[model samples]
Each structure stands twice: as structure tokens, then as C-alpha cells.
Target: MARDPFATADLEIVGQVTTASNVTLVCGADGVRVVYKPVRGERPLWDFPDGTLAGREVASYLVSDALGWGLIPETILRDGPVGPGMVQRWIEQVRQPVGRPELVDLCPVGEIPEGFREVLRALDGGGRPVSLIHADDPRLRRMAVLDVLLNNADRKGGHALDGADGRVYGVDHGICLHTEPKLRTVLWGWAGEPVEDELLSDITLFVKALPGELGDRLAELITDTEIDALETRGRALLDNPVLPLPQGTRPIPWPAF
Candidate 1:
């Protein structure tokens, strides 16, 4: 069974890698995998305080839970051998032919794949109601919208998970929360298309409800200014005006779905 962080010689140190952030791995513990962060750090972006990424990771999972989205990695912040770090669900990927990793913010308009489009359709929420989807879904237009409002700069392709039953997941929300538009993702191939009225209303309802359920969490992590801006955007989307959509972010990235 999966267990909490514990001091154990069983945690075999694995090789280091510099893909997203420098991460250390510990393998071969019954149903356990450990990811470690180094104290001697890299050049920090001044906006976010040092050692804040862990908190962001927690917050992202919480938000994903709130939305009832299964696309986020299962994570917990626990006392580790070093200090405090996050323990996420261990993923084992067999050799399967998938598309190349692509960033949603930099996705070319014409390069979106069929699976990406299918996930967007799944994420559309249709004409029924405004509900939450998992943050892990790669074709997460709503998550992307939230990412933009929160200024989540780390919404990478690999970070967006492709689940076991062919669902997408998302992770690594360290750089979220900002007051700027920050809507530069590669998931919007439908920029010229009209925003559907049903989905627009759903965003309206979701934003209106945020103050009740999401407000408390948002208050702690982000500034009041940002919360208000997100509300404003939701309302604007509901109104369906000819406003400038988030540029440079296609709704689907290649190999994303």
C-alpha cells in the first residue's frame, strides 16, 4: 500500500535529471517513490518567494480536487528525510507510441492532434452546467483559462498528464498566481470561433460560485486583485463580447490529448 514519508534506508537514490526542475528520485520501496528537492538551489525568479513551489504544488492539487478533476497527480506534503517535500503518485510508463512533448502556450495553430481535439470536446462541459474538471487534462481550456488568470507559467506538456484509461492529467503548478493577463498558452486553435453560449454561462456560474468555495483558498495563495480579475474575466466570457481572447495560446497542443 502507499505510505507516508518516512526515514528509511529502503529509499534507493536514483540518478538526477534537469528536465523541469532538478529532482532526485528514490526507488524500490513497497508501493513508494520519493522525489527530493535540493537545498542548494537554482537561480530563482524574484516574483515568487523561495521555497514556495511546494506550497503551489499543494494548492494546485487542492484546486484540482475542488473541480473534481482527476488529471492532477495525487500529492501530499510530508516530512521527508531532508526537510519538507511533496510525495506524488508514482507513474510507470511503458513504451507506447505517443506524440512528442509540446507546450500548450507555444502550440502552432495547425499542429493540434486529433486526441487533443477529443479531450477539448470532453472538457467543453457542453450546454448542461458549469462543473469542475481535473487539472491533469491536457485539453483543459478551463484550466488554461484559470492558469492564465493565475499566471501559471509552468503548464508544460509533460506536466499535463495522460492518464491510464486515456485521460489527461496536469502537474507542476509552482509559478501560478499573478495580476497580469498572463494568457499565453498554445491550446486555442478556435480563437476565431464564437464562444458557445452554454459554456459561457457555465463559466459565469462557476466564477460566481468561486467566492464561496474557492475564495478562502484563493485569498490565502493569491492577492485580492487577482481574484477580482478572475471574476471579471468569467463575467466577460459570459457576456460573450468581441473582446481580445488570450493570444498565443491555442486550445490544443500537438500530442497534448
Candidate 2:
């Protein structure tokens, strides 16, 4: 059997992501820069079992790849310096021009940008009124749909990246693909809107592939119950073909960015 270079390359830790909840290390795997999240470093959550987050991250990448969305960077579960972990290609964000609104951002109430949709209206730390908004971008719309399928529990604003390669990527998918519905995210801009025909078609193909190769791959990363839930979500999306509105009190994660 051949070994995957991304999984077999020697990793050299370059830095640590202090802001991350888990022990995230920035490393150079041979010449490839990547983010390494060792399972031993995962913080135990009440809902998810310990040592499972890394696999979930890899599972999210597999689904994203299957959808042909490229919404997530290339990721693999492999042995790193600390032990087995999730290793994902590092995405260098492209810097936006000054005064340009980000993919997700805050704008003054009533002054929402033309291509943006307001998700929330609230006061800033300075007591100034502002609206939480995201761009009406097809790339982002695809990501929102992916999040729905994965039942992504946390999609913070910081997780969406505008890559230097001119693509949007989502990261930090450690808490996803649970059997329970846990679709918290910052992308409610297209809530209740009918999904575009092309995206739906892609999803149609994804659902069909679920019981075959994709299912087998996901079974290795997540439980059978989670895979079944994923299929159910995909079928539901196809039946409705509409972006869901925020549900429950905490549809969006706290400290969104």
C-alpha cells in the first residue's frame, strides 16, 4: 500500500494557536504548512466524547470534498508529534482592502451594505447600535448548506476564511456530525430562501453517494447513527430545498467572531 504524503511527512511544530480552545499547533509537514490538533489535547465536552473531535474534523472534510464544494481544506487523520490527530492544510487568508466589509461583520443599523444581509441587531460594547451581517455570496451559501448537513454545532465568524487562492474555506469543525441536531452558525443570511438549483443538484448526488463509498469512509470517522442522521439531513434539504431559519434561542454561537 502507498502512504499519503500529507499523513506520512515529518511534522515540525512552528507555533501554537493560543486563542484556540484546544491545543492547536501550527506545523510544517515537509514543505506543507498545516494545523495539527492532537486528540490528547482535545478538551472533553459534555456532549461529545473525548478523542473523537479529531475524527469529526476529518469527517467534515470528507463530506465537504464529496460535495465538491471545497468548503474545507484538505484534512487527514494521522500521527503527529503529540500522537494521532487531525492535520489540515493551512489556509492563508487574503487581506481585504481597507473599508471593505468582511464575509461576516458588523455594520451600523440601517446602513447595511448592498450585498449583505443582516442576521442580528444589537448594541455594541460602546452602546452603539449595529447589525451582524454576512455577504450574499454563493460560496458562503454553499458553506451554510454544508453546515446544515454536518449539523455543525459551532460555526463562529472566525471560522470562515477568505483564502489567498480566492476561495472561501471553513475551519475548526471538531464539534460536528452528531446524531442530535446542533446547527449553530453565523450564516443565517439566506434563511428561508430557496436553495439554488445547482447546489441542490450537487446535494442530490451527495445523498446518493452516502450509502456507498462516502458512507464507508464516514463510518470509520463517525458512528453509524451520525451517518444516518447526515443522510436524513441531506434528504430533508432536497425535499425542502430552502435554507432554514434560525431556530431555538442559540442558533448563532456566542462571541461569534
* Residue-by-residue lDDT tens digits, candidate 2, 1-257: 96665778899999999999999999997788999999999999999873389999999999999989999999998899999999999999989899899999999999998999899999999999999999888899899999999999999999999999999999999999988878999999889999889989999999999999899999898998888989999999999999898889899988898
lDDT of 1 by residue, 1-257 (tens): 64443434244445444554545444433446645443233336677653456655655666556545454667555544455555566554333456443323222334454334312332222453222112323346555544543456555456654555555556666666555555444344344345545445555556767788677876665567756766776566656633244455553333332
Q: Name the top lDDT candidate.
A: 2
lDDT of 1 at 47: 70
Per-model TM-score, in order, reads: 0.61, 0.96
lDDT of 2 at 133: 96
Off by over 4 Å in 2: 1-5
Candidate 1 least-lDDT 10 residues: 129-138
Candidate 1: give its CA RMSD in angstroms. Answer: 9.4
